[model samples]
Target: MRHHFSEQLDLVFDELAELCITVQIAVRQATEALLAGDGAAAERVISGDLDVDERRDRIEVRCFRILSLQQPVAGDLRTVVAALRMGSEVERSGDLAVHVAKVARLRMPRTAVPDELIPVVTRMSEIAVDMMGRTASIVAERDIAGLVELRALDDEMDDLRADLLQKIVGPGWTHGVEPAVDLALLSRYYERIGDHAVSVAKRVDYVITGERP
Candidate 1:
């Protein structure tokens, strides 16, 4: 019975890892579509979000099953609970990517990001993607040490969002208010993606050390 319960827990962790990978790909593709102004790619990202949602639902169900059947205690309980929370984190990250893609689609023929702000937006995407990748690694490897670097990457993402906002509101701004608003939303979406990744990593840390970080 113990061995079977362990297997069930392993399956839940495996599903969470796969969900993280799906979210990471969504973030990358959404950023690419945003930068390139590819409406088709953006549409793809928007539609793909349903799969992420479904995966999260499956994770939740599995976690509940383990809780009901195995009655996990102590560290095992922490692991199951963390999996539930991490599933939501990654699913929300996927939604943020969809939000980024929607902005790209809305802009249509022209890119939403202006020429001057492209570099900052690009860097923000890079950091967001790196954070998601780290999240996937942390889940699969159960590496608590990687959480420090993941948190650092999140801080860098926040800084990039701040810089992007400053550029939008600074003098010599020729893009006007509408584009500025769109760019602001894009920055928020990317920043939120990093935030979700950090949340997931922290939950993993809690599962490992049996203490919230």
Candidate 2:
């Protein structure tokens, strides 16, 4: 029975790892679509969101099943609880990526990002993807190895969001208010992606250390 319970716990971990990977791919794909003005790619990202959400739901169900069957105690309980919470965070990240794709689609043939601001949005996407990949590692290792790294990535994301905003509102911004609004919304989407990745790390840390990081 103990071995079977351990196997069940492992399933929860495996599902979470897959969930993280799905989210990371969504971020990368959405960023590509946003930058390239690829409506097809953007559509792919939008369609893929349902798959990620379904996987998240499966993870939640697995967590509850383990708890109901095994009645996990102490650290075991912590791990299961953390998995449930982290799955939701990852699902939100996936939704953010979908939002990015929707923005790209909204712009139609024209790229949503202005030429000058491309570099800023590109950098934000890179950092968001990096942080999300690190989140998977954090869950797999069941350690705080990426805790500090996640925080630093989030800080960079925030700074990038601010810089993007300044460019939009600054006198030099000639892209017009509509385009500026699109960029502003895009920056927020990427920043929120970074935030969700950090939240995943914190949840994993809690499971391992039995204390909030």
Residue 96 displacement in candidate 2 (angstroms): 0.5
Enumerate clash totals for all models, in the order shown. 0, 0
lDDT tens digits, residue span 1-213, model 2: 789888887788778878888889989999889999888889899999999989999998888888998898988888888889889999999999999999999887888888888898899999999998888888876777779978998998998898778878999989898889988888999999899888889888788778875
lDDT (Cα, tens digit) per residue for candidate 1, span 140-189: 87886888898888888888888778878999789899889998898999
User: Every model's Cα RMSD, please?
Assistant: 1.1, 1.1
TM-score for each model: 0.96, 0.96
Candidate 1, pairs of clashing residues:
none
Q: What residue runs in model 2 are displaced by over 4 Å at the alpha carbon? A: none
Q: Supply the TM-score for candidate 2.
A: 0.96
lDDT of 1: 0.88
